[model samples]
Target chain A: MEFSKPIKISRRHVLKMGVMGSAALSLGIFRSQLVKSKTGSAAGSVAAQKTEQIGFMYDQQKCVACRVCQAACKATNNWEEGTEWRRVLTSDKSKAYLSISCNHCEKPACVEVCPVGAYTKREKDGIVIHDAEKCIGCKYCMYACPYHAPQFSDDTGRISKCHFCYERQDNGEDPACVANCPTNALTYGKLAELREAQGGVDQLEGLPNPELTKPSWVIIPKKE
Target chain B: MHWHWMIIIYLFLGGLGAGAYLTSFAAEKGWLGRNSSLRRTGYFIAAPIVAIGTVLLVFDLGQGLTKPWLLIGLLANLSSVMTWGVYILAAFIIVGLLKGYFTLTNKSAPNILTLSGAVLALATGTYTGLLLAVIKAVPFWATWIMPVLFVASALSTGLSLTALLAPLVEKKSFCEGREGRAHILLIVVELIIVAAFVGIMISGVNGPVAKESVALVISGVYALVFWGYFIGLGLLFPLVVYIYRYQRSKVPVIQYVSESPSATSDLAANEQKGHHSYLTIVSDISVIIGGFALRALVILAAIPVWDGITIL
Candidate 1:
């Protein structure tokens, strides 16, 4: 009732707030987040059963970055010129390559951010998929994805990312990128088996920690 | 990057429109003032402003609409911010139009209806913040403080907008009252909260990305606009103007030594009051400008930290 009255600024209030802010900043709160960045990066969502969960294994030692997987993905998914869901992101001077897509993580950030529920992670196989019709092309998924996985098409105004070739997987075939790898660098299998084959490791020097979204992939570091 | 000028405009407009409803509710319920004109003016302005914001958001996301689904049958993504926004915006428009019509027809509405509208308005104000805050990968945006900051600014914008418009629309009862003081207070609150929001973000979670984003706005390419326009012109300038007006209003006038309580003296005093009331216009406009600049600059300066292709 008395809100119309003049507001008096309190010194004690200001001091308390100032102290709190200083403590938060001086404690290196931001830097602490970096140390905790990899906290849960090694594990998948616990609620989701690990049994028969679809996953991938990328043996960087065997990869040659031939551009064949890139071609195969474009041909299969029919991505336009200057668009390839499967990309060979390589280092300077042709050092090595890291191919990534919708990690199809157990906890997919893209699915959570899609306003219209356009992006979904399949319950059965744990494959993340994008629905063109449902999508408003908001591109929230682009920012939501750390991998830069979703590609926006100017023609359709919709984002299309790798669904990990769910259609092929449903037919008991490897995803295009895995199937067309020249040196047998890419492989697909059940999550448990892939992790066993990968020696149960998730961290790699160049790759982001899987704990962020618990990506269902196994990457074997190229032997130095 | 997707949160561009269009999104910023939408944010400003949405807050403006929703905030009007809140002010109206306060006026209608005798919170800010028992001025019925404040309520009527609020109802009148609410629908049209919100419509513009909602339309801009639709077009921005729809990519200028070749597809039919762009305008209709929005999904109820419970986890998504936009989903809540869609529903809230729709409710605000309906409530606003209905209230506007009721006020136009000179009919008093039930308290329940007005209260519901106010609640919807609050949601509308907060939803835009949540929309950005839910972006998990963008450390620059993923913060709980975002919604609080947005709501504060929205309320400030709403109060200022009401003060700004009351003079033009219903000058007799509303503009020359306690709303100016309230507007001044709200902007000051907004300024403090904005600083806190930045501090929280600067000290928030996520590694290099959040740090870079804070840096980007404070001292990076966005420094000029953020500091100069938003803080200087929008917050500080408006603050100075409004505080000066408030202080000036508090000091009793000498009546210009008329030595007689005549019609002309009364007229002179009224004329002075009118000019003082007009001062609200400057401060309100400053607040609105500051609000828009803040939203737009935040979006413009946001640098999404991409997970690097770190070659080892």
Candidate 2:
């Protein structure tokens, strides 16, 4: 049997497709704007005004891998043995060291995947915190986090991670890690200001994609 | 990532129990032919198997035993896959027990009840896979194929468990009839799906972690279990046994077309009595072993995306 020719598209068909595509694109844009405006109304505006998304700023150019941040985090949280809330992973290919803890993400996976609502991102500051009292310790959050931020402790049978030193921040003090960093590599501030100050480069070598959780972090890449 | 053997056994049992319930439901609905022993055995074992798995799951949790009330928190997050699993598992266990009860009491269960239970069984089966797939951190488990492969494995393993228990349930030869054919088809499909799963992941689309995961299973640490136990014993062994039995016990075409219905049935019964022998039992056990190995290997070989990176 002979094969049939492929279906042909004429000028009229092309014009029709173009018109339909343009209409759909315009409708989508209009709908997005409408939704945005609706969500930005009085109550939303007020909520927005009351909140500032907190973020971390790290300068890889200055970190000496001394792990003072890690030590400070451990001391601040008083975490059990075998739990490192903040870890410094050195790059194999380079001398760069990434001192990381929970990014306190805008799209925090821990908040989304914690079955018992153990983890919550505060509306006022976007600081993600874990309530150990509510944790069932299923550890789904550990697997959900692209950054592997949530630490599971067999000793406590619960999950915990960087709380961004919320208590200290509320008391008008820098986080223990930030305050303890001798090189002034670690800092904290409103995410927008941090991004603006750090040139908006949140991702570094050995770090996960910033887009995954929209992590409230900014990093200054190490000089090669 | 510390899921270990407890989660492996839990996932296997959950899928197996769901699969067995489905297999029995299919039999009861006459989709796999009338085998009262098969139906009863499936109903009897499904709920208890799932219940045991649930217990293991709970026990694996940090405070599952000391503060069991904390389990109520599992229902708090509608977005969490584990929350969905809690609901599915609860409904499945309830309906599963009810079905078993009706079967034991010799009462005909309402079609609605059986149908919903079957649907729940399916959900339970699919949910086990979906639970892992939804985790974005583990690139290997993030694919849609995980659920498909899991469903296939669950069905095959469920059928294997039912077949393994059928003879003991009735103290007769577990006749390798239509069930054998179905088993062969399921195994083949499972093999294909496994291949596709490995192929897609290794093709480098999912990410480097996914590729590393495939490497771990294919030729890395888990390669031994993946190839030796899962492929050789679980899939191929049962497949060969079923195919051999099928070839050995082909009823003559003339006998099937016989005018005397009683004679034909008598011959069929006698043939079935000799077919599913002790060899079939061993094959079924191999399948169960393979199922457990499959779950363990998948869990162990999953290299999380953020394990560490070499490049800037």
Candidate 3:
């Protein structure tokens, strides 16, 4: 068989191919930057529109170890026996009192690990909400929550947690626990404002590190 | 949070089923001289063992039996390890059952199906460990070694179980051959992995809670279950029996092959080397018990890094 003559390329053809490759690479880089900026701006706008996070503040110096907040929370949620959403933790070392409920953390592990999507962190106020209807009673959230906030109910076979008293807050009323605190040790407001204005710490001697979940809570540590 | 014995059983059985299927697959591939009995025994047991374990898992769920409809929601979150587990388990169980059926009917399972089943079996075995390892709350469980240890234990126990049952099913001994060697190797590897797993946690690299968990297993609350059941009975006892018997089996091979042996001696020799010998039975049983004890100890000894502010 006869072989075809060898193909030849001039300097112009080589230069044309190189130029075209460079142009294509530059366009690809430019397109990616454009897409990234568009998405970034969209995220920024969404972040700006999000409502301020509501947080709970506890003054350990003022608390008298009263179990009334726990009772009020039970009254508010009407939880069954053996279930307490708010707990009064006392430290024998410092003689301090800590009344803790759900911190409604920024990176809620319960929200991330629930196989059934039963837990959700609210966009409006950053309140971590538990939807009982959607719960599969797997108790995964119970293990996932660092705060031990999600309480399991044997009756309903579902989990419940502090919802920041969102219904009462919507109605411009304090949560039952905060409303009923005789010492006014428990308070609630915008998390950022509370942190700035109060200048208190997010963690105390007995609390889990705030970095785990960035809990929407501020505490006035007890004086030694 | 405490998981009941059902979870422990489920973890134990899941690994066993996967391990058995693997052993059977190896036998089918000519590991045991093309013994259809070994293959059939493994195939028959794998799927049903896993299925029973799965049923216990479902019933253990808070709403599993009362509100069975909620189980469909297990697939809702793809990022959740439990959701991935559901998928892996479902596929493994289906393939296992189909393989078992094919073996029973004396039909050849497709190579693709067989290969997929093997992959799924390994996944199922690994997934059992990964399930606990992902829980960062328990520092003792959240280790890279968790899955590796569980896989080794699964293979060891699964092979022991197949060895225990093969003679009854096939009326012959497979315990004196390469199967014995493989079983011993698996047990040795499992012992090393267990040591590493416990050593890593107790050495304080994982933190105080992890150390506390290890203490609970090694010398504290679950010490008996860990030391007596898992270490002595599950691992060491079986290791001793297999080693002794395997050596004996090797020494007598020449005598058994010679025609000079008397008929009475021949019966005694056959009985000694039989798969259903009292030593083999006891060793296999010990391995099986140890497997259960290991799972139980793992589940019971996990001390969470924190149990919330209320407990503190």
DockQ, in order, for the candidates?
0.21, 0.24, 0.20
DockQ, 0 to 1 scale, candidate 1: 0.21
Docking class of 3: incorrect
Best by TM-score: 2
User: Which pairs clash inside model 1?
Assistant: A40-A211, A41-A211
- By TM-score, rank the candidates, best first: 2, 3, 1
Q: Model 3, stretches more than 4 Å misplaced?
A: A1-48, A197-199, B31-37, B172-176, B252-275, B309-312
Residue A21 CA displacement from its true place in model 1, Å? 46
Across residues B1-312, which tens digit of lDDT does each residue of candidate 3 receive?
A: 457799999999999999999988888886643233467677778888999998998888878888886666676666677877777887787778778766775667789978898899899899999988877777888897998988988888888788778777666453333566677888899989999998999789887888998998999988998999999999998888878866765665465676432332334345545456787788888999999999898888877667665323
Give TM-score values for chain A, per-prediction: 0.72, 0.76, 0.76
Name the DockQ score for candidate 2: 0.24
Candidate 2 chain B lowest-lDDT run of ten: B258-267
Residue lDDT tens for model 2, A137-156: 88788888888788888888
Runs with alpha carbons beyond 4 Å of true place in candidate 1: A1-51, A198-200, A203-209, B34-37, B62-64, B70-73, B171-175, B253-278, B307-312
Evaluated on chain B only, what are the TM-scores of all the candidate structures, in order?
0.87, 0.93, 0.90
For each candidate in the order shown, give its overall lDDT on alpha carbons: 0.71, 0.80, 0.78
- Candidate 1 per-residue C-alpha lDDT over A1-224 given as tens digits, one digit per residue, 9 for 90 to 100: 34222112223443655676455444433433442343233224445444356787777778888878888888899984444587777767447667766677877888787766667666667778877766787777787776777788877777888888888876988889888888988878888778887444565664555666788888887665
Clashes of 2: 0
